[model samples]
Target: METVEDVTRMHLVGGNLALDFVNTRTGPPVGPSDDDVLTGYPELVAWGAYAGVLTTSEAAALRRLSRDDPDGADATLSRALRTRDHLDEIFRPLAAGGAPSTSALARLRDDEADALGHAQLEGGSTYAWVWRADRTLARPLRPVVHAAVQLLTAGALDRVKGCGGCRFLFVDESKNRSRRWCSMDDCGTAEKMRRYVAARRVRARR
Candidate 1:
């Protein structure tokens, strides 16, 4: 298992916020995941800050609030974890060229609506949805929720893929859509080394 001390190592290679959010934990190509980095509310907020989902002040404020209201922090943590799992259920299947359950889609829609309820539109040339400024514990997660909506509505589901090396989710944004690893410096290099050793063994046996 990867020794993920904190969200600083989430890798942030998903190329999209929703995908990055779902990858807070990792699994195998055909099994369950045991590596979870976001162990609690503070870690969740740290991840949001690391992923650029939360501003520095927002992150600091959330941490301060967590100290004052531990129960509320725990509740927000539960919500964040649930949201992450909810996203995994929706995106994992889609990454493997399968459709997510209808119920999952419905739940995602409802979640988006709930997030948008706290949003206010503002702009000069073109307006866009922006979260209402507040110190609520759930603020860190609102951007993630909106990102899920954006990824779903963007109409490029085909680009989403599960990495051939580590089963991490990412979008194949290459011009030819041929990206196969979450990181060439990590998974890609490891895979190549494995193949190289295997090839050497085969030649030695001959």
Candidate 2:
């Protein structure tokens, strides 16, 4: 059985948000939060190109190394980070206005479906099967596709776009449609308070 540490390490290596979805815990010895997992997804969701081809032994070794040594885990994470940069190039256009239609996205979808059929019939490699199961020829790209599709089809780019804290992406589905901060509990409140204090200071100076 894979321990929580083992799975977390694998997720860092795999560099996929889906691994976070499958994860059973969070941090500070916390159990998983479906909300936090969805919101605070650390995986860039763009790493399929590099993480898709590991042999089972390689995957297992990463898990083992992650469990045993910080150095090994850091090395694997560094590789994942480099791959994430590559994925950024591939996914940047999707978020920007050039994303294809759902049908076109569906084609990427269908290709993997077809591959899964072939894998089922042939049963060559479990890793290959896992790769195909993601419904993307590129495994970590789906979230970008999901967000892009939601944006384009709903035409919510201007309203839904922008992460206040950083370059992180998210769909702002606030009912008021005035959501300024990326998160109310975190950045929203803090930024608001900071602005308030700054305004007060300016008044005092005046």
Candidate 3:
């Protein structure tokens, strides 16, 4: 039942790539459901392109590579989801002023190291992570792991928030730092209607 528009509507409002990655799954803050938008390798590659982690040509190449090596593609998708879950465990607490678990940190460390191993120096001073156009199934995850590292190390952890309705993670970059919903067009409107109905019911009772 997924349409092109629905797939294209993947939330990018997290303000941070890694937080956006975690928002792929839709659910509550504590119990995010299994409704992952990246349902397959092609979807994952499309999301990578959408996230700016992969160029259009790179996404096309990855699609061809995945078609050729289904097993590798499956493994890569599994790794990507696992990485997202680890990030959820790590960042959720940090956003709440608590420390991440040692296990979660260890997983992130391993992902970061893996991502680094495939990188190459590009433009003399800037390092560009390169995954083989043919076989590097996990190439898309490198940038995501890097983004998570940046957010964790920077002073931006305090701005991370979960949407009040859907629990999607987003960075509250508002001037007042009072952002609460994942998107005003979606969860925000739904929440507003719920409150309006509740207030009307109270008035009717009175």
Q: Pick by lDDT: which candidate is best?
A: 1
Query: Per-residue lDDT of 47-154 in model 3, one digit per residue for the tens?
Result: 888888888888888888899999999999898999999999987887677888999999999999888788765656666555543248788899899889888887
Error of 1 at 51 (Å): 0.7
Q: Write the per-residue lDDT of candidate 1 for residues 1-206, one digit (tens) a residue.
A: 32325678668999889889888887675688867877888788888889887788888898999999999999998888888888888888999889888888887888888888877888999998877576788887888888887888884899999988775898889999999999988889989999999999999999
Give the range where candidate 3 is weakest over 10 consecutive residues by summed lDDT. Answer: 126-135
* Stretches of candidate 3 exceeding 4 Å from the true structure: 1-5, 123-135
lDDT of 3: 0.83
On residues 88-197, what C-alpha lDDT tens digit does candidate 2 reach at each position? 33233343445434544555344345434434332545421333333322333333333233334555544433335433333446687665544566556777899999
Question: Per lDDT, what order, best first?
Answer: 1, 3, 2
User: What are the RMSD figures for all models against the true structure?
Assistant: 1.9, 11.9, 2.4
TM-score of candidate 3 to 2 decimals: 0.89
* TM-score: the better of candidates 1 and 3: 1
Count clashing residue pairs in model 1.
0
Q: Give the total clashing residue pairs for model 2.
A: 0
